[model samples]
Target: MTSDSESPFLQSARRTLQLEQEAVGALISRLDGDFDRACQLILKCTGRVIVTGMGKSGHIGGKIAATLASTGTPAFFVHPGEASHGDLGMITPGDIVLALSNSGETSEVTALLPLLKRMGIPLISMTGRNGSTLATHADAHLDASVVREACPLDLAPTSSTTASLALGDALAVALLEARGFTAEQFALSHPGGSLGRRLLLRVSDLMHQGDRLPQVALGSPLRDALLEITHKGLGFTCVVDGQGRLEGVYTDGDLRRTLDQYSDLHALSVDDVMTRPGKRIAPDILAAEAVRIMEDNRITALAVVDDTGHPVGALHMHDLLSSGVV
Candidate 1:
């Protein structure tokens, strides 16, 4: 019920988003040799990329570490506060360190600089100030500076954090491409996610085979085909020849059409009503692809066939949904 002129919340929210968007845009022009050097250091490292930061920077560092890990780079987050106590041991001499500090002078993070230097570990710093202590000590410094904070008071870490996150994503994507990371490899890292299901869940994994498959002989009576469909609960049955090779498919849709054209359902056979050269899929294809085919053909189910054209299995729309492949 509030008017736009009186509602500071909506206006403030828009200003924040606009400022953050501009901050991210500014990062594109700032990319230079330092960014490439950071990528090279990470690529050459034999061990994991150890990320550390303090305060709001720490939250962004954790997300950056996760993105790097999931995108083929071996990376993990170690709190800078914890590093001073004993967590520094997690970082090995072979690892590369990515430290985040908006001011480039976080005490918790700077405290470990000398020790890491002595250990000969490469340091990559992301900071707003080019002349900050952390940036000065870093082997490669990435400028993640923002012109102003989204906060009206310019106190909260909003635009700066957003810019840092976008830069992290850029680095991860560059490294992912350099390593020739594939969707299959990504799926291996994210087996429980929807992307993993789409890339890894093949037709063979979800298809019904043997007695579970809804199928009948090509000469099967229309009643027999209907019973097969009812028993299997797939709403369709594949019709195969005497050699068990797929010949056609008879579904509820076909049954309705037959009923409309001819009232004698008992006298009809599968050969009379079945769709010849019905849509078929191989078992090795992705279940997502099956969904696409079913959608494209306006079908609810499909028959899985072997190289010899023999019916091996059946895939239903419900199976795709149940397995999270849809």
Candidate 2:
């Protein structure tokens, strides 16, 4: 009779996690010359990294390829079975092949060895068996061995797959740093995602430009500036000089401060009450940078200017939030 405290289900789950965790930890000591050689081979390759595997290894290879591609390394996955069926045409002479197999005996993956060698393409093998045929014939071999599977039967691939995935991530990140890949470059590759929008989207993309911008000429009455702010709904309006260069900005906060200083607001000019040289950003700068500027200064709006400090556009906190740039 199994008691609730000694439930076999809970015990099995905990054991599985522990085994897999230990398997990944064990890989730390195995990082040696082979791992370094693999990275060097991939780094020097002028062409894309071609990842190939069979069955469960293939699924992990696909994810590895994706992570590498997204992190500034050009990589893609090709199924070993498909590679045998004329899909080997995808491999160019300049490319590097990364083949994954736990036992290093996957027939589909191993069968491509002769052709890869014949083509003079560099091959990096990731396998558990150091003496396996696949490892012996490779230019570089990455050992992804495990003591045992997390499975109670010790047959299913659980810990082995986890180790392979972690190793793949480590390789990709190392290469990314080696190449000096910047966030802007990463954003360029992932333009459709939220991260891309935040890093790549510039102030010009979200700002209200031209007629949509709320602006009043220098010396305009406070009443006119307030009306412009209300009409444009940007919470503020830029006060510009005769040459369109920015003079100041008048916001609701400025209005409150001015009212406290002077009981009569209508008699004053926009320049008199406006905050001089308020927070501003260039049109070409990142919207994320604009958000940082706004947050740092504790302001919600900013004037987008040109090289001459001329008011070109207006940016608001709502603009960033709505566009997923905040």
Candidate 3:
């Protein structure tokens, strides 16, 4: 009955958290035969998982569909109300329909039951009532019942929706594991995401190759090496041999130190001033691994080399950033 602003807000938040926590706990305990059967049905579905719901359940269904799609399970959301009109054509016999109805009586969702059955597509129901018409008609039922809603009126879908979301996540993770989904495969599905970049981006993809690579022969003047560095814009040049094997590297840092020791920058040879035995990586290494190598070595760039130690390409920290590998 506290009417004060702070007290009411805190009470509402606390109640909401408590209700959602209880809903999650309930869903965890209810993972029995029905939950296993639901997983089995989805695993065997060769086409996709068509999710349909109404109102608050519709919002949850959209999220569930997204999770399933991103986790290697092909799924899409269809509004049951729209399904009756024409969207139902999106579903086929190969797909399994997952219908959501909190009260098990949403007419919009219930209306699709007969059509799904006629197509021989299995129906998996997620609802609060185990004995409701939706559950009885479903090939598998997932109990998403909650003790109560966080709403004081006990009417709004607060806890029930949260439970549905958790159950959906559980199902997604289960499917992801069942399909032996690897990080590389997941990355292919999400090439624009950070995780995707970390898993799929290789050093060869971002490394400067061909004529863009900065290089200078042993005994080449420091001024010429600096020009190569400037032209390449990578702030460094590799010292190479007759066979183009890396002998050393001359960086901006090395140039600064060299300037203090010698005033004749034009006369100094790269072999005389270059840092010997510089760090290098294979062409096939991952960009993420390149980042780790740079961090551990406290360097900003790396020279990519072939098995014979020939400088093939160059990679910079900015390369990883631009590619979203870091």
Candidate 4:
């Protein structure tokens, strides 16, 4: 490898980055009432937003469609060439069309303008030229124009495509906020990911309950508490009253403190060292909340309690980690 201080490859890479940055940056000022109108149109649509484009725009359109669909807006991409064929039937009367084209006169995309108009489907155009055929025929035209392509020959689609993708992302986010989309709702849309696991998995789902729960009476010998912690492998044990309600907890930290404060371990009862009212969570609460509670209090395990304050289960930080929610 050459590893030159000023390699031509590095120079080209930097130029491409600078141009693409400016391309996306230019979109900020162009955002106006048309952006709002486009959002309103999609939000009001009873059906999906049909995105169409030719060449590079089609690739960006596909990503835009995915973002919109995942963020609460129902949307999908259709190739302009395919739409000209029998695939135009995919677009229904209730649907809206979002067309992308840099030149704004791409024959394949522009050909659909008349058909969309006759069907009374609202059209939102994202193009480089506002006066171009596609933009002039649309209900709301989004200007995604860039100064020039990052290509040395100004031929390949680089800056223009980046700008279009950014605009698509802007549209999806604005519509997401306008429709009051939330993290919980987004988690529902993406249930296979880590965020979904964290949000959807409840404490009851991951907690150790019944026999597996480490628990003993408050007045039990400290030796008994240590045995429970070791047996359950949760590094902590819940100390309960005679009524089975949680009175306190004895953890590895408490064990260390006890060793420092007292000379004898067998001489103590759980009441001599257990932390009263240790951090607890309801079984119905989200496991993510349990994680937050553990994080804020700097504790590893939590007592899962019922409305009556009886420990029903036990949760450990390891449980969250193993579940891919940490």
Candidate 5:
């Protein structure tokens, strides 16, 4: 039944996005004391922020809860209807409530107001009307009002929901800044993800250790170092002194350069072709940091050194890549 001449549908779609975009923009101009107080409350909240809403507003509330939780503010969403049916136990006196409703008069959410008040919990309501019952009962009212709904019928939650989401993001970010939340702390909470891999994984975890490290004595013949590289399968070897201090590194690139200058590979010692005082990393450094160092210097592998600059381990770009740190 669809056709190329669906001009009305296209116009409606464009209008909806435009209206939602404007609502989000309006949220910034409306922000004032209440917004600041909401952030302060969340930052000081010893317990979680319990987010509650009904229907479409509930969907937006769920995302808001996730955003707050990930950005240093501990939060979780609770369905208003379920809360009335005993999920109210989830909200405690130490917790703060974030209630979302476009009309600001959802019966399910309103029913919990007295109990929340009696328990001495703070209420932050995101609603379109400042005079609505929910707003009147709230300790802080975030204006999520839109001039009109994006729907042609003016019944859908589009613009109002967009405003609510933007305001929620603002609150979460403000709390994040007030708490001095760092990227490392955020990564700790997200330890199962790529962020965790980048922050928590160390070079020591991926670098070849003990007998597997590609290493040879400083005066070892180039052929013997090449044998070490082959045996370790890292495409390179560290050249160390008798005291285990890193003197230099020999790589496939060095082999190619040596081949161009002198055809006698067997007669050369590792010291003749090795790159001196080559790029190195500490074992405790993040693998992502190691990748950064390698990428910044345009090199493939680095010798993992100890406190006194002795080579304790070695790693290649492929090692980081395979370990999901690159």
Candidate 6:
């Protein structure tokens, strides 16, 4: 797809992608008892899963740790080299150690095997070799071998790392299912994310209440309702009875219709111009449900009512948008 000089590089890129794809695909058949054992070990672990690796494998291990932790498995990544230093103190007897090494013979990773054993910690090894030192010492060995690297020289940790990462994802997802990890729980782990906003945010968290709410008596002058709408900037005002129970709603749109139907604007009460029994929602509903109601009814706001049908709060489309619930 390029000029003659660039064609060779493009071909190389295509070949690399093809090789990596095959590498991940090859791991499908490799899932066996060992993979299940790895999940079991982590599930049984009362403490955190300590993931460690060297160089590029460390990068992949870090990503795997994040995936596991966010998906309900308690995990964190520590560098294998750092473990030989005072960092090994971070590992306790209750923790499980997951070591990543393409060759299964990285000196730094292998060095921790004895310390982990002395502490009575369980070991799960992901490696390219089945009989290497780390794999042989592991309680569970995940075979991550690849036929060849995407690098033409087969010297870089290309295909092997991809396969290991995929295998780690498989292990995490399996454990997630086994533990019955729910989306709400996942949202708790990621409270700063948009998914958390959708799953955990409720109507009360974003609704305007008290002095911020716009409301008027049902029998009040239309001018009084209009003043409430203009002052509150919610595009509408709730018309309520003496007991504060909602009787109707009047919005800017209703005002337009009122002007066309009545010549004497000063003579009308809010009850005559308001939409009676206006669309309302409870304060406990998910903000997402409120969004659906607004979209379905082609309206931009709703009155939040309590069990007694009294207006407690006002919600507008802008509130949802500003709160990142829309």
RMSD to true structure for each model, in Å:
2.1, 2.7, 2.7, 2.6, 2.7, 2.5
> What are the lDDT figures for the candidates, one per model?
0.94, 0.93, 0.91, 0.94, 0.90, 0.93
Sliding window of 10 residues with minimal summed lDDT for model 1: 1-10
Candidate with maximal lDDT: 1
List where candidate 4 sits over 4 angstroms from the true fold: 1-5
lDDT of 2 at 273: 83
* Rank list by lDDT: 1, 4, 6, 2, 3, 5
Per-residue CA lDDT of model 6 for 190-280, tens digit only, reads: 8898889998999999999999999998689989999999999999999989998999899988989998999999999899889989999
Q: List model 2 lDDT by residue over 1-326, tens digit each.
A: 33568878878888888999999999999999988999899999999999999988999999999999999899999999999999999999899999999999999999999999999999999888999989999999988999999987889999999999999998999899999999999999989999999989999999999889999999898999999999999999998889889988999899889889998887999988898888889999999999899999899999999999999999999999999987
* TM-score of decoy 5: 0.95
Instruction: Report the Cα lDDT for residue 317, model 6.
Output: 95
What TM-score does each of the candidates earn? 0.95, 0.92, 0.91, 0.93, 0.95, 0.91
Question: Scored by Cα lDDT, where does model 2 land?
Answer: 0.93
Q: Kindly report which residue pairs in candidate 5 clash with one another.
A: none
Local accuracy of candidate 3 as per-residue lDDT tens digits, 1-326: 44466686788887789878988997877888988899999999899999999999999999999999998999999999999999999998799999999999999999998899899999999999998989999999999998888888999999999999999999999989999998888889999889988999889999999999999998887789989999999989899999889998999889889989997777778888899988899999988999999999899999999999999999999999888888
Evaluated at residue 105, the lDDT of candidate 2 is: 92
Q: What's the distance in Å from true for residue 295, model 2?
A: 3.0
lDDT (10s digit) by residue, model 5, range 1-326: 44567798786787788899998998888988998888878777889999999999999999999999999888999999999999999998799999999889999999999999999999999999999999999989999999999978999888888889888888888888888999888988888888788888999999888999888998898989999989999888999898989998999899889999997788899999999988889999989999999999988999999999888899899988887777
After superposition, candidate 3 runs with Cα above 4 Å error: 1-6, 193-195, 261-268
Q: Model 6 off-target regions past 4 Å?
A: 1-10
User: What value does the lDDT take at residue 132 in candidate 4?
Assistant: 99
